[model samples]
Target: MAEITTHQLVKEFPGGVRAVDGLDLTIADGEFFALLGPSGCGKTTLLRTIAGLEAATKGRLTIGDRDVTELPPGKRDVAMVFQDYALFPHMSVADNISYPLKIQRVPKSSRHATAAETADGLALHGLIDRRPGQLSGGQQQRVALARAVASNPTVFLFDEPLSNLDARLRLEARTFLKRLQRDLGVTTVFVTHDQAEALALADRIAIMKEGRIQQIGSPREVFARPANTFVASFVGSTPMNLHTATVSGEHVKVAGSSVPIPPSARSRVSDGDEVIWGARPEYLRWSTEPVEDSIEGSATIVENLGAAALVTVDAGGTLIQLVVDEDDEPEMGARGWVVPRIDRTLLFDGASGELILDDTPTSP
Candidate 1:
């Protein structure tokens, strides 16, 4: 496995649309990294660029110690799995797995042995004789992965490889993929628009917007201490509640109430400063009775989330959401008080939307 590095990498198309806008990145040897963002955010383009499928407009790219910026895909020593599992319809599973070895001109006997071995390692037993059209989606995906593994490349690149599977299979494949990567210790870079997948699979993630990375950190760091308003809003499964308010003495006035400044961030703002006060629904306390620093509100919407429910409260005109246990869910039109955990809130500059506190507070 090899580390991948890019310095000021840029990919521009006609009419000056820069799909990968001067990205600078490094993936440690054997690290599982993910490029996460919404569609058209250039994550797939970036992955393709790294694969040498889409040429970088400018900048240097290196795989391990080799300068692969100008190399062709075949010469880059990288294996890539596409979203559709791109297997040959006419080829049986064994042939599909051995295709890369065939391309490398390995002897027929050796290639088939390697293919059989790789297939077994991937749990593709009994299905080896079946053609792509005969195999299930998960099987085909494994075949694609087996083909990639047969190459024994320096790095692995995945382009939403699980997107085609059903939810259950996707979950199973996700677990399998993580284990496979751990067992192989291949330096892997995955691109996905699904934040949940990225959080679950990546050792570290780079959240991008408009082709530029907004933040790069471990899943927990990105989720708990987002670098700015955009990150706080983008990374969470439940969007953080963000409210525009003016700084008061150790508090922010919003929704006709004074919400305490997250304890560690209180000194970051002064009286009369404008800021965006934010809190995650899961970190909020909901009560029917009055609570200190509570925002008085009435439940306007309750969204079922399996064992929990998301209750959207209309406080004055601002809506704040809280994740309540299903049994504790307040009925629609019920008045409630929303209290943010004092140490779990965030403060961002109102004008720039940049996080203002250097020390992001954490729950005790």
Candidate 2:
């Protein structure tokens, strides 16, 4: 296992468009870290640079204690799993998994033994003789992952390995991948655009935007206390509802209504500072009674998902969403009120969009 580090990493393309810019990261040995962002955000480029598939225009990369910034892909102790599975259709599962060892010219006996062990570990033993075209998508993906690990590389780089699978298959694949990584204890760097996948699998996530990392933290940290508006809006489903507010003493006035600011945000807000109030969907409770932390509104839309319901309430001009018990969904055009779990709400500086107390933890 190895710790991977990158300092001032940068990648520029032919049109002078910078794909990755001034990135600095350190992945502890045996840690599962993820680079998450939208498309065209440079995560893929950074991964390619680390893998030695794409040279960095400016930066230094080190695996464990060795500097590999100038090394070729073959020389780096890293393995990559791509989205396409990339298996040869003509090759059997055993042949596919053993391909890397074959390329390095391992002794035939040792290669076969290692391949069998990996296949068993990945639950691919029964399908070893099947060709890539004959296996299911999940099985094919497992073959790709198994092959990548058969090399025993120090670092495992995953480039959206579950992107092609169906929703249910993705979940299953995620569990398998996480279990495999946990058992192997290999340092891993996963790249994905799916916020849910990143939150569910990564030990720590680096949220990227426009070629730069906006925030890096545990899934809980980024979800409960986002670094900025961009992260707040992007990290969760039904993005944080943002509203302009003015701070006065320990109170913030939003939409002409006064809401007491929690003590956690006290030191971060000045008396006259303009602030933005944000509440996540899960924190907002819909009810007919007036309550502390409650705001009045009219129900505009309701989506009753089997387990829970996502209700949208039009609070004056702002659309506030509440994820409530499925049976409690209010009818459209009904007058209602929303009570936000104060401890779960977020506050940001209006002008900068940065969290008021980014370094501090908030109650979940």
Candidate 3:
């Protein structure tokens, strides 16, 4: 296994566009890490650079204490599985999985034996003779993964490998991939624009934007304590409710209603300084009447998601979403209340998108 590191990595293209700028990463041996961000944010560029497919304009890469910055992809001891699976329609599953071993000139008998074992382990034994054209999308992806693992490379790289599958297949593939990583203990680095995929599979994730890393931490750390507003908003579904407001004495006014700001929140800001407030839908509740830490609004939409319903309310002018039990869903166009759980709220500096210091109050 290899621990990969990059220092001050830079990548430039024609027309002087810098796709990746001063990026640094440290991935431990046998750890599953992910690079997550939206498209054009330099995620794929960074991954390709690590794979040696694209040369870095500047910086150094080391794998297990060896400097490999200048090595070619084949010589770097890394195998990459792409979004398209990159399988040949003409080759059977067994042939494709054995190709990596053949390239390294492994004994013919040994390669065939290893291929059969890998196919059985991946539950693809019965489909070994089938070509990519004859298999379903999920089955084809498994073949691609089986091929990468058969290489026995120290590092396994995935670039949106499940993007082509449907929702159900994607979930199943996610489980398969996670289990495979743990079972093989391969040092893996996967890149995905989907936040949920990152949260689900990664041991730790590095969230990126505009060619720079926003934050790197475990999924729970990133979600519970977002480094900034962008991360808080990007990581969750239904989006966090953000409201701008002024602080005066112990009161904060929203839509001309003076709601008492909790003591914990008051200590974070000075008098008259603006702050952005955030709360996830799950931490909010609906009520029949306006109350403390609450906003009155008209129900705009109600979406049933099996066991729970997502309620969208138009509060004066702000649209707030609330996650509630199925029994509590309000009818659309009905008057409702928005009660926020202050303890679960997040505060950010409006100008810099940075998180502000807050002393969370203890619940009685």
lDDT for each residue of candidate 2 in 201-271, tens digit (9 for 90 to 100): 99999999989999999999899888999999999967788888889887887765667775567777889
Predicted structure with the largest lDDT when compared to the true one: 1
What is candidate 1's lDDT per residue for 80-171, written digit by digit as tens?
99999899998888889999999999998999999999999999988888899998899989999999999999899999988999999999
TM-score of each: 0.97, 0.96, 0.94
Clashes of 3: 0
* C-alpha lDDT of candidate 3 relative to the true structure: 0.85
Q: Per-residue lDDT for 290 in model 2? A: 76
The sequence of per-residue lDDT tens digits that candidate 3 reaches over residues 222-325 is 87667888888888766777777666667665544545565445677777777777778998898887687577888898999899999888878778888989
Off by over 4 Å in 3: 255-266, 358-364
**Which runs of model 2 end up more than 4 angstroms from their true locations?**
358-364
Please, what is the whole-model Cα lDDT of each candidate in the order they appear? Answer: 0.91, 0.88, 0.85
Superior candidate under TM-score, 1 versus 3: 1
Candidate structures ordered by TM-score, highest first: 1, 2, 3
Q: lDDT score, residue 56, model 3?
A: 93
Q: Tell me the TM-score of model 3.
A: 0.94
